[model samples]
Target: MIKTNRIRMKAKPAGNLSRDDFSVEAITIPAPASGEVLIAARYFSLDPYLTGFMRGWQGPDPRWAEGIVVGRFVAQVIESQDQRFAPGDWVQGEGGWQDTEVISADKLQKLEPIPGVPFSVYLSVLGSSGLTAWAGVNGVLKVEAGDTFTVSSAAGMVGGIAGQIAKKIGARVVGIAGGAEKCAHVVNTLGFDACVDHHSQDLQGDLATAAGAPITAHYENVGAKTLDPVLANIADRGRIALCGLIAHYQDMNPIALKEFRRLLISGVTLRGFRLPDFAADFEQASAELKAMVISGDITLQETLSHGLESAAGAFLNMLEGKGTGKHLLVLEEK
Candidate 1:
C-alpha cells in the first residue's frame, strides 16, 4: 500500500486566495479497481482561473460547495488495472493538487511524446494556455498580414504565444507587461516588436508609441488600465479578443469602458472567449504550436515551484505581479 499527499480545497476564499484555503492531507492509495489506474503527478498547471474556483464559483444556481480539491495536473500512470494505459505513460487532465490519484483509464487523455520537446510544454505552450492563445489569434482576432497586433499579459504563457503567432502572420506585435524586466522579456525573448511597461509613468504614451500606427488586432489578457490604453490605440475596424482579465481580480469591479465612443466610431469588434467551448479544434492548435516551438520560432519560460505547499504562494505571487513567467508546481518524481 502507498500513501499519497493531496491538496484539498478546505474553504471558500475571500477576495484573494490564502494558504489557509487549501489543506494538505495524506491518504492511503487503494487498489486500482477494474478499469482504473493510479498515477503520479508530474507537473501541475497553476492558472489564474483557479482564483475563481477558490473564491467559490458562482454558476446559474450559485451553488458554493467545498468538498473536492482544486487544480489541474499532468500525471504519469504508475499502476493500472485497465488495458488502455500501462505504467510510465503521461497524461493531461484534471488530477487536482495531489501527488497521486486513481482515475479511470478511459477518462485520461494519453499524451504522445514530442521528440526533444520538454515535457513541461504539455502544461504551457501545448496546453490549455497555448490553445487559448491560438484560438484568440486565429479564430477570434482573424489576424492577417500587415495588421498591428498587441496583447496584454505579454510575458505570460498565453500572451507570449498569442503575440508570436500574430508576428508570424506578418503583423506588428506589441505587448504590455507589468514591469520593465517583464516588458524586456516580452520584447527581446518572446520576439515582440515592442512591449509597453504598464507600471511605467508614461504607460499611455509608451503604448501609443509602441503601436506606431494603430492596432488592428488586440489580444486582451488584463483589464483595467491595460484595456483603456489598448482601446485608445485601436485602428478602425479593429478586432479584440477578450481573454483573461487579471487587473480586476482583487476587486471584481468591472472597469467601465469610457472609450465605447471610440469603439463605436472605430467599428472595433470585441469577443469574449473561454477556450473549452472550442475543444474540438484543440488538437489542431496543439499541432501548429508544437511546430513553431520545435523550430525555435517561439520560446517559453516558467516560474516553477516544488510541491503543492507552495501552490498558494505561487498563486499570490502571480496575482501580485511577482511571478516572472508561467507559474507551475512540480508535485513529485514520476
Candidate 2:
C-alpha cells in the first residue's frame, strides 16, 4: 500500500486561474495489477494547455474531466506487475498531478539514461516540447537554409527549441518574446539571430526590422497578439506551424487575428499541430534531440519549483509569464 499526495481540481476557474481552484489531497494507491506499473513521480510539468483542462476542456478521453488535473511527469517505477519493466526504472507519461500513479505498462514510456543531461530534460526538450518543435520546423514547415524563420514566445520551451532548430537548419531565425530580458535571452542564450520584444510600443515595426526579410516560415506559440504581426510580414508562399496560443488562454473573449486574409492572398500554408499527432516519430526525434544536446548543438533552460505542494503556484506563474524557460515542479533532486 502507498499513500500519495496529489493536487486535484477543486473547482473550475471562471477565467484566469488562481491557486484557489486546486486542492491537495493524499490518496492510498493500490498495487499494480497484471500488465501494470506503479510510478512515483519525480518531476511534474506545468504547461499552458493544462489551463484549458482546468476550464472544463474534455481531453482526448471523456473520462479526463474536471476534478483531475492533467499533466506530464517523469517518474520512477516503484513496482511492476509486467515483465517489460522492473522496479527503479525511470519513465515518462501522463501521470497527472499525483505523486504516485498506477497505470497500464503501455501508457508509460521507459526512459534511457543520458549522460550529462538531467532527467528533467525528458519532460521538456527531449519530451513532448522537443518533438513538437521538430515536427513543426522540420516536418510541417520544412524549413531550409536561407529561409527567414520567426517564432513567437521564443524563450519558452517549445518556441525556444523551434528557433534553435531553425538556426541549426541555417535559417535566419528571429524570436518574439515578452519583455527586454526574455528577448535578450532568446537571442543571446538560445542563439536566435534577433529577438523582438512583443511588449514594445512598435511591435509590428520592431519585428519587421529584426526580421529584415519577409518571414519564410513562422512557428507560432503566442497567438492573437503575435499572429497578426507575423502574418503581415510573412513572404508569399510562407509556411506556418501553429503550435499554441498562450496569449488567449486566459481570456474569455480571445482576440481575432487581423491579418488572416494574408494567408489567402500570399498563398501561405498554415497548419495546426499537437504533439500526440506525431507519436510514431517521437523515438527517432528524441534520439536526435539527445545527440544535439550532448554535442552542444542545442541548449535547454528550465525554471524549477520544489515539491508537489508548489505545483499549483508554479502552474499559475507559468501562465502569467512570471518564469523563464520550461517550468518544472521538482519533487526530488536528480
Best model per lDDT: 2
- What TM-score would every model get versus the actual structure? 0.94, 0.93
TM-score of 2: 0.93
Once superposed on the true structure, which residue ranges of model 1 sit more than 4 Å away at CA?
57-64
Q: Rate the local accuracy (lDDT) of all candidates.
A: 0.82, 0.87
Tens-digit lDDT track for model 1 on 1-334? 6788877667666557777777787878787899999988888888887666667654222222543455567889899899888998888777557788887888788888888876778888888888999999998998999999999998888898899899998999999988888988898888899998888887778988988988899999988578778788889998999998887776777678757687898998999998987798888998899999899887878888888778777777777777656788887684
Candidate 2 lDDT over residue span 175-274, tens digit each: 9998889988998899999999888887889989999999999999988789999998989999999999888878868578899899999999999988
